[model samples]
Target: MRMKHLAIVAALVLGLTSSAFAGQKIKIAGSTTILPIMQRVVEAYMKANPDVEIAVSGGGSSNGIKALLDGTTDIAMASRTMKDKEIKMAAEKGMNPKQVVIALDAVIPIVNKSNPVNDLTIDQLQAIYAGKVTNWKEVGGKDEGIVVVSRDTSSGTYETWSHFVMGKTRVFPGALLQASSGAVLQAVAKNPRAISYDGIGYVDNSVKPLTVNGVEGNATTAKDKSFPVARTLQVYVDGSVSGAAKGLIDFILSPEGQNIVEEAGFIKL
Candidate 1:
């Protein structure tokens, strides 16, 4: 009789544990830079597991980090790597931040379709954006002045270029700064002599990407590590995360989720 009672207790405990897990839901939030790719993963995962409620938000990387620290988000999707200040802030709050590189992306240099230039060496790109090579004629295009376009100063993509390409130099004056990658692509598409940078996933036939240091934007260059401006897309979470957050991370790291990331034009890690 004691053995039967023990079996009954075990079954009851398992039932309650399963019920608790099924009852949970989680919401994730993060930067707009990875929205297109992240959205694809979230929607598909939700469909497969209807019990899991995955909500996404886009308020820039800073806002995402803020949400994570405030307990408003389960995960923070950041385009750029985490900053030292952000990491230190989490530590002070007893929140351990962990990162996962979901995929790789490129910071593509784009020019208007009508523009005759096909590629720009790194030096030429810097000079054009620094107001040194003002005219397109200097770069084998029209005689008109080059219109420099850019993302907002707060943008991760902007920060990447400033550090890697511009090397802390100020951009050329009269440059137009948009707030998002989509906005940057749109602005470049509209301007005949405009040049801008955006995440490579945003690149299409609408605008052409110029080579940096003679390395083209292709799969071979990416695999061989010749692509100069590529960066990793990161997902961050509090170290104590469990239950729903843990499950969500598993889903993202799983082959199924990575497949979605790859299909969305990112290099799945």
Candidate 2:
């Protein structure tokens, strides 16, 4: 009877150990635009559930979706909805991409703090990016030549800008392309004649955000759809997510997660 009791106790201990060691882990990758809010969500979630492990990375939205389809990541963060081609590509790989809208973002055009140009009409913006308006003087600024800073093609922000601001027109070849919003901020902040566009969450006193068609880019404007450059922020999962991935998604859509989104300067859904 003593030997049987000891065997039962050992088995219980081994089972508990195995369960603890097999705790869920999830991988998330994608948009720099969504990085700040996602990081905060991950931090809070990890703190609440110490057993679960999550890895987050930003390599632009395209790379994130690619990682998801490639089976390397459980979640893909994106600022724009998945393209039909991307959806078809995922289907070919036997993966169904599901999107969860987490927040709303406004892509605000920014210039140096010293820039005197306060607002730009959509037509003027289109001309500026198209290289037709090369000098600041033409747009009611200094006589200095305009230095255009743009996001790389891999960025969802860039795609949105191309669609709305550029009117499907390609950015001039002379524009300087940066890989992330932070880089665009840094470049514009230092160059008085430089102009760029980034998510409103990234705008601070370091740069001046331009009014689009007399409308300001803010959470209020974004929510009302008055902001012309607004886009929805989302996270993509493979069909139905389970375990850690689902937990993270659930947390992001929760009240606490929405609070984090607002605190990060994004508009909550």
Candidate 3:
């Protein structure tokens, strides 16, 4: 009996050891928005291949890119396209940046639920950020001062918003610069006089999404090119990725991933 028990224990130990060494854990880092979607995909992959492990993190696009360059991360997630200089830097570093489009997110301009203003044209939005439009009454809202809220320069959302909405114009001095999309949503939701922008994923019942040039920002509008603020969510792969990393990307572009994107309040691309 003792000899038989020893044989069984030895076999189990060897099997466990072999399994541990069978596959490698894939390291990944991404933007906060991409984190959830990526996680869902990874979890699904793990169900089929239990030997693989995936690690994810978020420190904004720049930070994700930095991690890839510095070898701290294997995958970089971005909400916006890489800048020309970043692509050049990757080349200089002997790293190839592989871009995979995952989803579409509208840079939804939101206002306090109490604010009656609902519609805005491109020029009017440009004026508001450029300090030209100061009163809500000018755009058919309440006869109150227009309080501008915005994201800081470090935010990729701000970069896109400034480019598409401001048209290379500046977001006038004293505009409230929140840190993240959630913060922007919160500020706009609570302050009746406030107006700010966010990722479509952040839109909810608490705040109201404005119609830009009379175009609504739903998945349909984004797909039809009517959502003026719609932007692509991207995943950047540095060097060759393991099956795990590739699987995560594939999932984001898959039906399940798109479902998660839609459930998160963003548009599925």
Q: Write the per-residue lDDT of candidate 3 for residues 59-147, one digit (tens) a residue.
A: 67777877877888878878878889889999999989888888888788889998888889889988989889999999899999988
Question: Which order, best to worst by TM-score?
Answer: 2, 1, 3
Model 2 poorest ten-residue lDDT run: 14-23
Q: Which prediction has the highest TM-score against the true structure?
A: 2
Q: Cα deviation of 194 in candidate 1 (Å)?
A: 1.2
Give stretches of model 1 more than 4 Å off: 1-23
Give the per-residue Cα lDDT of candidate 1 at 102.
79
Q: What range of 10 consecutive residues in model 3 has the weakest lDDT sum? A: 17-26
Q: lDDT (0-100) at residue 64 of candidate 1?
A: 75
Clashing pairs in 1: none
**Per-residue lDDT of candidate 1, residues 1-269 (tens digit):** 99999999999886664454565677677667788888898787666556667788776666777788888988988888778998888889999888888778878899999888887887788887788889999988899988899877666787777777788678866788887788889998998989999876788889878888778866566656688777888888888568866766777789998887778877777
Number of clashes in model 2? 0
Model 1: lDDT equals 0.80
The all-Cα superposition gives candidate 1 an RMSD in Å to the true structure of 4.9
lDDT per model vs. reference: 0.80, 0.92, 0.79
Q: Please give, for residues 126-172, the per-residue lDDT of candidate 2 as tens digits.
A: 99999999999998999999999999999999999999988768899
Clashes of each: 0, 0, 0
